[model samples]
Target: MRGEGMIKVTLVRGLAGKPEPHIQAVKSLGLKRVGQSRLLPDTPVVWGNIKKAFYLLKVEQV
Candidate 1:
């Protein structure tokens, strides 16, 4: 899980006043604060969550 198929998802923006779903998506990614990041598998379900909160995240391949 630490190889080519991993992606880094960072909380680049504050979640203040964001919609419930978007907040939940970020939380599900294991991020709880600005600047926090998570190394996640690059799969459809994770991608779906990232897409839901794209504006609040910074995604990059690792």
Candidate 2:
């Protein structure tokens, strides 16, 4: 199991045809293309962004 302080977010879906804000959220998470991944801090702000773009991403504890 991974610790609580970090998360791994991967872009599993494409951003084309998505809403502007959703695209922004994905970019803000540092994912620019499908299969891209980022290790980010586990905070409410990040969580909110993830939730907003949840359909385009896969998230796991890191």
Q: In candidate 1, what are the lDDT values of residues 1-62, reduced to their tens digit?
A: 43349999999999999999999999999999999999999888898999999999999998
Clashing pairs for model 2 are none
Top lDDT prediction, candidate number:
1
Instruction: Please estimate how well model 1 matches the true structure, expressed as its whole-model Cα lDDT.
Output: 0.93
TM-score of 2: 0.91
- Assess the local accuracy of residue 56 in candidate 2 as a C-alpha lDDT between 0 and 100: 95
Q: Candidate 2 on 10-57: residue-level lDDT in tens?
A: 999999999999999999998998999999998888888999999999
lDDT of 2 at 3: 35
Per-candidate TM-scores read: 0.92, 0.91
Off by over 4 Å in 1: 1-4
Tell me the spans in candidate 2 whose CA falls farther than 4 Å from its real position.
1-3
Global fold similarity of model 1 (TM-score) = 0.92
